[model samples]
Target: MYRLTWFATNYDVNREVNNGRGPVDFKISKGSRDKTLVEFKLASNSKLKQNLKHQVGVYQAANNTSKSIKAILHFSQTEYLRVQNVLRDLGLSGRRDVVLIDASPKASASTVSDFNQKGFDF
Candidate 1:
């Protein structure tokens, strides 16, 4: 998905890029001087705390760029709270560089009848 989005643009996106330090999830760059690292993780991951602490910094150093983004997906409310706590512990709360995605399943709009139907003409 990331690759497809950046494919048409001048940016180049690569996954699991290894630069000696270790392989990062994704690397988006237009050139050596313009590079950004993106790391994806699950909220339920066992190493979530450790990864949130030291992973991105190492990747940035290895890739020679200080710019990076961390994205974590939570499947439930509990997982979301857990991620929040972890981020708080790591002093990264409310940071724009860290993205928290809620991937929990939801009921379809058609199946949900709580909407105001007065404006519709079915």
Candidate 2:
């Protein structure tokens, strides 16, 4: 998705890029001095806390960039709560650099009669 979004732009987006320390999920660079790292994780991952604490920092240092984004996807309310707790413990509860995506499987509003009666058309 990142690649597709930045396809016509100057930014170059690569996946699983290894810069000696380890492989980060995605690396976006416009030039040698312009770069950002993006890492994706599941809220249910066993090492969610550890990764949220140290993984992105390590990747940033390795890639020689201070900018980074961490995206986490949760499949359920339980998993979302777990992620929230971990983020709060790490003092990153509402940081913009951290994005939480709720990908839980649920009925769409368009398919719900309540939404239809409310004049919401998907």
Candidate 3:
């Protein structure tokens, strides 16, 4: 969770804002009063696949803004591939409103070499 004060000076950023449908993750208001909705997700469960298809769009309409961002963090290669496939399925793979981040720790050269020795690629 982020504190509003972190971005209040630049933009009025609030978390867990319920516009109508439900509580959105965050909403940041620009100088023109247009709100930019942001949602964060961790690729952990099966439901994430279904949620990614429409959650952000629902929040955007509820918040009365066309601009939004869905920030998804992948902690492993499996999670990363799942998100990638879901985005491609939803036709949002290259959309500007989507922000996918790789949060997995990198494998050291030694670790990669060990994997290669075992006929695996890292």
What TM-score quantifies how close candidate 2 is to the native fold? 0.88
> Model 1 clash tally?
0
Among all windows of 10 consecutive residues in model 3, the one with the lowest summed lDDT is: 1-10
Compared with the true structure, model 1 gives a TM-score of 0.88
lDDT of each: 0.92, 0.92, 0.81
In model 3, the runs with Cα more than 4 Å from the true position are 1-8, 106-122
lDDT by residue (78-107, candidate 2, tens digit) is 999999999999999999999999999998
* Model 1: ten consecutive residues of lowest lDDT: 113-122
- How big is the positional error of residue 68 in model 3, measured in Å on the Cα after superposition? 0.6
Tell me the tens digit of each residue's lDDT in model 3 across 1-122. Answer: 36635643777778899978998888888675588888888978677767777787898888778888888888999998888888888888888888888989886766553666778766
Model 2: which ten-residue window has the lowest total lDDT? 109-118
TM-score of each: 0.88, 0.88, 0.75
Off by over 4 Å in 2: 108-115
Question: What's model 1's lDDT at 29?
Answer: 90
Model 1, 1-122: lDDT tens per residue? 76687767988889999998899999999887999999999999999999989989999999999999999999999999999999999999999999999999988777867466646555
